[model samples]
Target: MTTTTSGPPAAVRSVSPRATVRLLGAWHTTGPAYAALADALRSAVLAGSLPVLTRLPSERELARALGVSRATTSAAYARLRDLGFATSRVGSGTVAALPRDASRHEVAAPPPAGDAPASDTPSADPTTPAADDTIDMSQATPSASRALHGAYTRALEALPAYLDGGGYAHLGVEPLRAAVAARYTARGVPTDPDQILVTTGAQQAIALLATTLVARTEHVVVESPTYVHALEAMRRTGARVVGVPVGDVEAIESVVRRTGARFVYLVPDFHNPTGRSLSADERRALADLVARHDVTVVGDETLTDVDLVGAGVPAPVVGDGTDPRLVAVGSASKSFWGGLRVGWVRADPQLVRRLAHTRQVLDVATPVLEQLAVTDLLEHRAAILPDRLAALRAQRDDLVDLLHERLPAWDVPRPDGGLCLWVGVGRPVGRALAAAAVTEGLRVSPGPLFTPDGSGQDRVRLTYTRPAGQYEPVVDRLRRAWERVGGR
Candidate 1:
């Protein structure tokens, strides 16, 4: 019988030798050097760091970059091809790919190890096991707030008012825009409805801002181990991402000055993974530095409301929020319900219009029902936030206590706000531990997933978004994984 097969996939783009080397973090564990290199490459491919169809640097080039022999690099490439994490073509050289038989449980790249919306977490492929089968420690978002259902129900009652008009709300429905603007105004940053552009989520807000402000071959300064997906959005604009130490305004200024970077992305309120918030002085310094450099700043406040210590969320990075160069993104997914997919951008009215126009090519509008629900939820936030905070605080405390009890060697710092603890595992075994976790039916986001240059090999982010009851199992799984990986 004759059979037909699809043609080989073509490489859309090439990752540089430097970037390829960065992705292979801590590959020198006890194993054959080539096998170790191949394993690292395979892990990166499976983790979605080296996305499928990306052309790898040539073997010789990578060998030179990695300080390894060309034969080692060649054998590593061959191993990658044998395991189906890569394929070769005549002109494409080597490209990342997934095996045809790869299972869903194996392939869904772990979500960025930060405060991204739970709904945005990478999920198993269609053929993967059920949700109950795996302990997902990647996404740092909470369950739907208790108020979400009532808000949606009210939205349904209010839906008919928009039935007569086209559902397209390119700038978002007026109520949601006004609600979002009012919240920003109350947060000490005066805002008007026109300055608010509602998006499907904070992620979409970031992408919209990236598309609107960033240009090809420009520089975008970011925090090291910042929001990884934000890096993806900025890089998609062909902008080079330059990372500085988190919360270091001096480093930020230096990078901006040296690179002449016109764009800056910060998670100043409560940083993901690390769960660190910039001090008031740091915020002021960042604001002044961005202003001085004529830099456009995107302050991601997705986790601003996840206050475990009740210290109240800090002010926006750009305090005034009127600067045309300052844009702030907020999301209901982290605070209320990920399924809502509701978020907003607060920026200059002109930029808001530009974003709305640019967003049309991507999505004409966020769903009107979701917008109305978000509006209702925001209006009732006073009733909802306390309960959400209480639950998170308890869960966070429980996870911390459990980790301390079970994994005493790891340094687990308590974050004032934000959903995850960025724990130091005392060894560069994040990738190994994550792999081991999977064998125990747990999925994790290792440290490398959070950084642009793949330098956080000694860390792992663990979210307390899971119920308190599951904290023990989560710790148990992590403990077993640590043991399996021989974590110090």
Candidate 2:
């Protein structure tokens, strides 16, 4: 009964008839057809079985799927709209929503500081647990590395050199850009400083790319369950955002060929949520595919350096960023600290120039000190990674083992690298569990937050960024929440 509706802009996600019918079990109670359908839909939304913001099937589609009269569906939809459980848009069709009076505060108030999804940048307010006992599993980030202080201190000592200038580093400081370019070159992708344009963070780099490259009505492709904020950035560009399954190169090419999409975004190395890294063959295939299609492929390597296993990572997907179509974006957040707020685009110099120009309207420059700090981190990256990777690996293993022992029904796969574990809880109760978790002094992201389409209802992403000792409590809270949501 999980919903399969895609998210905004393109509005392509819709609940399949089969899913809708399954959700409406014994919906035809002792009541009118329309009332029964409306009640059932409402109950599903309230129960979190049918997540808010997903598109429901059309009246005709639902009628055919459920073997009901079209009039019954039409009336049911009308009732849903009237009850504020759904909204019908001109092009977007019926989207699931919540009425103001839905009493969702059971999951809303006393907002958890870590309730926000994974991001490398710091929030205006410092993040803290929702309560004294709350275990926040919402964000997939570790505390700042100890080496960050030294980097910032060095940056401070170096700050006077730039104070004499106008300080408008629209293209970022030279040293940091060169450092980023050097890091790529070390990884077997030869890059130049001119080809790198630094931004406030990786999120800004994405926003800048979307603004510069994605034209209105042009198509953009992302993995089905992608980084949510990246999806939001693409949708904001007014582009038709479509999704292919993660690591599905053929599916990506097919969608591009069919839709004439101009941009394809990927997290090829240590992808967030699923933590799947592309093999060397897959990377080569994607590089060739983008070249053949003459479409721009944005490879987000924000999590690239977070290799938990000593096994070396593959080279950059763009293969030196010589192709104007292959853009590689990276960040200092995962390796050093999110507070530094530094990211960059390694692209063709022409695209870098264009992104820099586009970035002015949104944010003119990254902070000078942050850029300097990140440069220091990059220069000393070899010294910084071992401990970070060790901690992350230990946490990942502990969490996986704990989940297997405590919630045996949940499928917890061990990924070689990455900060989060995308788990299958063996039930379509993710949203319900998240809501219940809040009451159990836990904050978590439901699987729906990771995807444009609502197909991952039986899934949830658990971050292993916290200490190994903290995981037992996290699993305990999750177990309590799972049971509350009817999971065995």
Candidate 3:
């Protein structure tokens, strides 16, 4: 009886088991299933779970483990290889690799030394650094106008006769010059068409001024945290730039008196990066000091029209009639659009002629199309300006609210006008924070980019031109980076 029972049990146990098939989820079975899987893997890699050079699972093993078709797994692996995220060998299977993005290497590298030369220097190649999405807060520019198309169209219609004339005159279109002069008059600086000389942009205006005024090794006074590019331009002309502290009238006056500087470069209207406007008394004092010292004041009013806050603030160029030493520079680039590329220097007629003659050696003249476009916008200023001011104001408020909510540690002064907020990081981590931000797909203009001699390492200028939706992510990323750098 025991033998019979044992025999039956052995036969039943020896019977072969049936093969079973398992189904994969829709993500694995779809036409682009491999792409979906590769994306998932990419997310994992970006999250730092799988570090660079780590070996990935074998295609066959992964397919079996995930219950997916071998072809699907192979395709996913191939996709990763193509993206430079993985590499495969006949015997070694696949291994994670560094991302093909050039910026990845930059992020991984140590922060640059504080005194490193600017990337824009003539000898320096900007393209050498693997191109990353750079958030350039160095410049203060406004967004394009909705009415630009109409303005440009009108300009094109008026361009035929203008084109027929000899195009090599260094002075810009007479009408645009008149328009610029009219703007100066409207702003309380009385001027004639003969007083304005249009240039390629504010940059060109600065370059021309610097070249014309500064003799080799001449002393040029600039605010301590002035626009770096302007400082560079002045320096390029062999001018010894003297930094004068802003916000305090006495500091600037003291520097002016002490240096006997030939020229003073200033941004009086909601001063760039700092957002501090000089009081009327301060402006009067500055004008008096410049007049007394015979220092030619080159007033950069690029941000003059971008009055988002402090709407009642007085103009910075109300010169005392005694001196007539002020050469005010205004640009449509910031008030309207950068693509307009139209700017004018408001000065005495003789000085304008000199600048025009100097400009002939550089750019023959400002583009006819740009000049006309700007003229049209200036003509319709009443209709277009209110909307622009309103939009900019809203953007400024939105950015301030976002900073307050997400990055309470950051001390951002709400600027009266201008497109950016000069933020105080309270520590010299601008470079480190910027490096960390790149890893998270954020580009920030470190404060040193604005300072002469690569100072201001504890600050960064943040623009509000980005719409509210775009602005939020930037703030979040910056907050994360700030936290990583132990920001206060």
- Top TM-score prediction, candidate number: 2
Task: Please report, as a residue range, the 10-residue window in candidate 1 with the lowest summed lDDT.
Answer: 114-123
Q: How do these models rank on TM-score, best leading?
A: 2, 1, 3
**Distance from true location, Cα of 317 in model 2, Å:** 1.0
Model with the higher TM-score, candidate 1 or 3: 1
lDDT by residue (tens digit), candidate 2, 174-283: 99999999988878878889989999999999989988889998988888578889999998989877766578786677667767887989899888878898888888
Of the two candidates 1 and 2, the one with more favorable TM-score, higher being better, is 2
| Candidate 1 lDDT tens digits, 314-336 | 67766877578877889998889
What lDDT does candidate 3 reach at residue 332?
88
Models 1 onward score TM values of 0.74, 0.76, 0.71
Put the candidates in lDDT order, highest first: 2, 1, 3
Q: Rate residue 356 of model 1 by lDDT.
A: 92
lDDT of 3 by residue, 317-361 (tens): 647323558888888887789988888888777887888888877
| Two-way TM-score contest, 2 vs 3, winner | 2
lDDT of each: 0.79, 0.79, 0.68
